[model samples]
Target: MTPLVELSGAGFAYEDGPPVLRGVDLALREGRALALLGRNGSGKTTLMRLLSGGLRPASGVLSLDGVPVSYDRAGLTRLRTSVQLVVQDPDDQLFAASVEQDVSFGPMNLGLPREEVRARVEAALAALDITHLRDRPTHLLSFGQRKRAAIAGAVAMRPRVLILDEPTAGLDPDGQERLLDTLGVLSGTTVVMATHDVDLAVRWADDAAVLTPAGLRLGPAADLLCDPELLTAAGLRQAWSPAVTAFLRAHGLLAPGAPGPRTPQALTELLGGRPHP
Candidate 1:
């Protein structure tokens, strides 16, 4: 399948400081959730910024849908239309006084007709389950509601790719679950969420891309996340799911031979007929 976005041999640095990302090659596919995993200073956010065209590569190439992305004003405008980024900090994205105003900003700026923009805003707010907040003051919203509003702002643009940085950072358990469920149902949009939460990454992403100082290593989420060595090399601790470990040991399927549980239901089914460990 043609990727929604691609980066080849791309590199970035800050004014001659040591390179944060180099020789990185990656492709974001359609309709799949990709988890960007790494420790601090491993360049995950740098890569995300590059993906969003917020930063251009110092070397190499980036393309969307097989066409190379140009950073010119017109091209960048088109890029932002197709690929929207939701910053981790809600305050960074939401500046309007009212929730409706904030969510309508993207589509409205895209030169959409007033009715179309209104419809998009209404749909976006519904998608994020923040419809009741339409007329509420942005400043009065809690952190979680603000995050949803920020996301709705991006969704109103109807982008093909949605990039979120640390989306679950301050969300409560219910908020996190609702957000994850919402991400799951966003038809035709490829979701790329950068998270340090290994467990969330493992359970949510279909494919995993790990970032180290050396570059990127991509694979099935199950394989990349369960490998302690790979996680350790990327300066992350192995996030072992108890259900996965118990099921694996019970079946004597460890490491190389095991495709452990990706969800709680799968874990339950695996141990359904077996005796307790």
Candidate 2:
């Protein structure tokens, strides 16, 4: 199948700074989640901006579906509707009074019918499991609640590809799990999220892509998360789970032997001989 989004040899730079991204190439296939991992100021956000058409690249090409993206009015609208970007900070995205209004803003801006917009707002809230906050003031919500609301707003757009920047930042343990579960349920959508939470990326993303001063590196989520040297070089740390380690040790696949399971199914296979809880 053709990729939902593609970036080829894309490069960008700010007014006075050196290039934020250099020769970056990415492809988001349907029904796959790609995690963009990097430290602060590593050009992750800049790449998102370029993909979303918020900022045009100084060179190279970015295409959604098959059409090249430009700064033209039609291209902007196409990019906006096809790829919805949830900003890192909820405060920047939530400007409406109520939670419902904030979530409805995107579809409303697209000139969708009032009923359609209402249905989308309701569905987005339900997907994020925040229907209870529909009437609450956005400013009064907790940090986690605000993050969910921000995501709901992006979901309201019904975009084919969703780009979330640092979705797990500033959340408590419960909140993080809840948000991960929310992301887990989004089927048939191409998701590219930039997160420093290595554990979250390991558990939630189908593949992990690291952003470094050198360039973008794509590989298995578990392998990338387990490598301390690679993580440190990219300004990241592993999110090692105890259960994963135990399973690997049981199968004699933890380092010294063969590589351990990088996915849940593999873990299950390795532990199939053990009695179930």
Candidate 3:
């Protein structure tokens, strides 16, 4: 499948500073979730911002669907409509007095008819399970609620691609799971996120990209997430599932062909109350 977005030899430097991202390449597929892993100051944010059209690269090519991305007013309007970005900090994005208005803002600004905007707002609220808070004041919402509201605002735009920066940050375990479930159902939209949560990234993303000062590496989650050298390069540790799988395999309790499950429920079912030998 053609990628929703592709980066080739992409490099960026801020106002004559040293390059933050250098020759980094990525191909984000439609309907697949791509997780970006990196340490602080590793240019993950720069890459996300570049992809979302917030910052243009000083060198190399960034394209959407094989065509180069345009940065002019007409170009941006189309890009913003096709790709919605939810920043890591919800407070920076949410400015409306009420949840409903906040969620409706994007569609309304799109020059959509009022009724159509209403429908989009309603669907976005329902999708994020924030319908009950529709009339609530934005200031009174909890951090999690605010995050959901922020997400709803973007989802209301019905973008073809959604990029979230550290979306799981500040979310509780259950909240993370709920968000994962919601992301899973974004059927035809490509989802890209930069997150510090290695465990979730291991299982959730269809593909993984590890960003280090050296460069960026992209591959299947299965191959890249479990590689210790790659993990160390990106300042990440081995994921928990692989360790458990190794232990069980060594103990002769698990079949050699047994599949390692990544999620909590999958692990619970796989163990089946089996006693440790």
Candidate 4:
């Protein structure tokens, strides 16, 4: 299948600065959850911007469904409506007085009819499981609630692809789990999340893209995330989930052909209550 969005030979650099990303090529598959992994300075954010039409590549092309992306207003509007980026900081995105207003902003700007905007807002709020907080002030929400609210604003646009940067940052374990559950509700949307947490990437993403100064590597999460050399090259450590799952398989506790467990609870269930050898 053709990629929903693709970057070919893309390169970026700040004004007169050294290149942050060079000759980068990436393709986002439809409806697949992707984890963008790299160290702090690996141009992950830059790549996300390029995908979202926030930045024009200094070289090469960014294509949407095989068509080259245009930076003109009409083209950008199409891109923004089809692909939404929710930055790491919710405070930067949410400015409306109330949750409902914030979520409604994007659709309203799209020149949508009042009823359509209302329906979109309702569905987005419900998807994020924050319908009850609709009337609340955006400034008064907790960190997790604010994150969900910000994401709801993007969801209201009904984008085909949703990109999140450091989505689980600053959240407690419970908050992270809740956010992941909420993300699960975005069933038809392709989700791409940039994160520093290798374990989260290993367990949550269907595909993994690791960036390094040397290059970018994209493949099945189970394959790339388990490779110690690739992890080290990307300045990431091997995730413990795969290690434990590998041990279980080696001990004959797990079927050799079975997919690795994504979490501690999943590992336990897969073991079928058998004691560790």
Model 4 has an lDDT value of: 0.93
Best by lDDT: 4
TM-score of the candidate numbered 4? 0.94
Candidate closer to the true structure by TM-score (higher is better), 2 or 3? 3
* List of clashing residue pairs for candidate 4: none
Task: List candidate 1 stretches off by more than 4 Å.
Answer: 250-277
TM-scores, all candidates, are 0.91, 0.87, 0.94, 0.94
> Model 4 Cα displacement at 56 (Å)?
0.7
Q: Which ten residues in a row have the lowest lDDT in candidate 2?
A: 256-265
Residues 76-174 of candidate 3: C-alpha lDDT, one tens digit per residue: 777788888999999999999999999998898889999999999988998899999999999999999998999999999999989999988998989
Clashing residue pairs in all predictions, respectively, total 0, 0, 0, 0
Q: List the residue pairs that clash in candidate 1.
A: none
Candidate 2's C-alpha lDDT? 0.85
RMSD score of candidate 4 (Å)? 2.3
The 10-residue segment of model 1 with minimum total lDDT is 268-277
Deviation in angstroms for 54 in model 2? 1.0
**Model 3 spans > 4 angstroms off:** 263-277
lDDT of 4 at 44: 95
